[model samples]
Target: MFIGVGVTIAAFYYYNNPVEGESCHIQKENNVAAFVMYGSYFYLFLQFFLARYFKVRVNADSDKKKKVA
Candidate 1:
């Protein structure tokens, strides 16, 4: 994931700016790809965090109490 994001960032940076002595500029497709990539990563992280930290636990014996004679 880190490598993918890093490469995407580098590509986006290179394409989004006009290079010196060159006519290279950002393209609509590249911009869209970058946005979608980041969005997907955000969704992945959100799902992982929710499942790992907010998961519910079931206890079947919680209602049973000890009787004192």
Candidate 2:
């Protein structure tokens, strides 16, 4: 998650800084690109965490049920 966030931020910073653009010119003016990139990364991380958490919970529950039986 941290790595994803770091990479996304770094990419955004690089995109925001254009080497040859004029001071008043804007390259990525919509800002949707950054939002989409960051959002996708965040969503992927969240899904991963949730899947792992649910898997652990399910295993623990099954173990408890077997012990009780």
Candidate 3:
């Protein structure tokens, strides 16, 4: 994930600093970079959400009345 984001940032910088007289394709680059960044963030958020949402109980409940000892 970090590698992908790093590459996207590098590409954005390169597009903004293209060779003189060469087409930078800034519009296309911006669109692709925006979607890539958004997708990356959304994907990470989903993973964390799912992990918390489906957490399993490995230990007994912590109620004082429920103590086995």
lDDT of all predictions: 0.74, 0.66, 0.72
> Runs in model 1 with CA error above 4 Å?
23-27, 60-69
- Candidate 1 residues 1-69, lDDT tens each? 777777677777777675788865557687678779887998999999999889895554664443331
Per lDDT, the best of the predicted structures is 1
Error of 3 at 28 (Å): 1.1
RMSD of 1: 5.0
Score residue 6 of candidate 3 by CA lDDT: 71
Instruction: Give the winner by lDDT: 2 or 3.
Output: 3
How many Å off is the CA of 58 in candidate 3? 1.5
Compose the digit string of candidate 3's lDDT tens values, residues 1-69.
Answer: 667667666667767688878876557657596767768897988899888888785655666547865
lDDT of 2: 0.66
Q: Model 3, residue 68: what's the lDDT?
A: 67
By TM-score, how accurate is candidate 1? 0.52
TM-score of each: 0.52, 0.39, 0.46
lDDT of 1 at 12: 76
Top-TM-score structure, candidate number: 1
